[model samples]
Target: MTLTTVLLLGVAAVLVGFAKTAIGGVGSIAIAIFALVLPTKESTAAILLLLLIGDVVAVWHYRRDADLVMLRRLIPAVLPGLALGALFLAWVDDTTLRRCIGVLLLVLAAMQLLLRWRSPDTTRIGESRPAAIGTGVAAGFATMTANAAGPVMTLYLVAQGVEKRRFLGTAALFFFGVNLCKVPFSLGLGLFDGETLWRTLALAPLVLLGTWIGLHTARRLSQTRFDQAVLAATVVSALALVVR
Candidate 1:
């Protein structure tokens, strides 16, 4: 890798580590960074691998607080998304894929704000079957397409009124599961090859370092502050993708 690529990956590593532990919603920035620096297919594979690293850290750190019921409900919905993502990825241009993810993030953010504003008290979005299916499908599709699943899941969890530590932990587990599950599909699509795998492996230590720092920071941030920071970062990165 060139110094520039290494530096960019370093920045992404730090943000990803922070997002996984502290905020639980910034991995997409890593996706954006890698996508910009590498081929789209390779970027997806590389980012997925890095994310899995982060996920392992998250699962280890938050294992005690996982919410199985929520994950159980969402998995069925997510399956179709995974299949669709794999199919689209085989044919879609990188530019189109990134833009689609950007638009989704923006829309999700707006919906989150609007829904909260309209009925701050209505946190669960009915907890009805329909809502669960919708959210799960959206989450799956978004995650598969861009590794941009954080915001959709974040908004859903926020609406579910998952507070603070449990919120972070649950998200950690959910994504850990999802990203791990994505590995085979990504590889099948030729996103991860011998060269990219070696490169990501070389960068593994940095991923660990970032996760450690982010996990520490996460424990320190107040719930309100963390949410705000995550939302803001998501907005900025999402906009960057849109404009790119």
Candidate 2:
């Protein structure tokens, strides 16, 4: 890798930690950074490792705060989506896949906005079973194909009325588990090579540092501000992916 790529990657690693520990959707910035610096396949693999590490720290910090039952309700529906995404990766063309994902995210963001506008109080909407399944499936597919599940998952959790700390805890465990599930396929496809592994190792310290910084920042943020920031970031990220 060139010096510029290395520096960008270090920045990306830090963003991963920050997203995991503090802001849920901000890690999508790391996804965009890696996609900018590396090939699609290599970028996904590198991100997987970094995300797994972040998950560990997040879960460790927020384990007591999450709603384990809600997380569990999401699993069965997610499995089919993951399998479909894996198949799509194996057979679909890259450009088409990107466009499809971009459209999906755009729709998700728009629908979320519409929902909030219709009901400023989101508690009833969050508890709907069908919405959970739909969001979980979409999140599974998005995460598997592009490591872009952050935006979708964030909307679901936020709409569900999860507070900041529980939100962090649930998201941490959720991504950690899904990323772990992705390992065998990533390895089987030869995405986890020595070079990427070394780079991930080299960038590990930045992830920790960023996580620390983000955690402090998150603690100081009001609940309302956190919600707005997450929604805005998700909208921006969806638009970027659509255009990229």
**Superposing every Cα of model 2 onto the true structure, what RMSD results?**
1.3
lDDT string, candidate 1, 17-78, tens digits: 77788776677777788888887666777777778888888889988887888878888898
lDDT of 2 by residue, 1-244 (tens): 7989889998989999999989877888788788778776678788998988888898898889878898887877777778777887777766666667767877877887888888877767777888888878888888878788888889888887688888888888888888888888778777788988898789889999888988899899998999988888777766666677
The residue ranges of model 1 lying beyond 4 angstroms of the native Cα positions read none
**Which candidate ranks first by TM-score, i.e. highest?**
2
Displacement of residue 154 (Cα, Å) in model 2 is 0.2
Candidate 2, run of 10 with poorest lDDT: 93-102
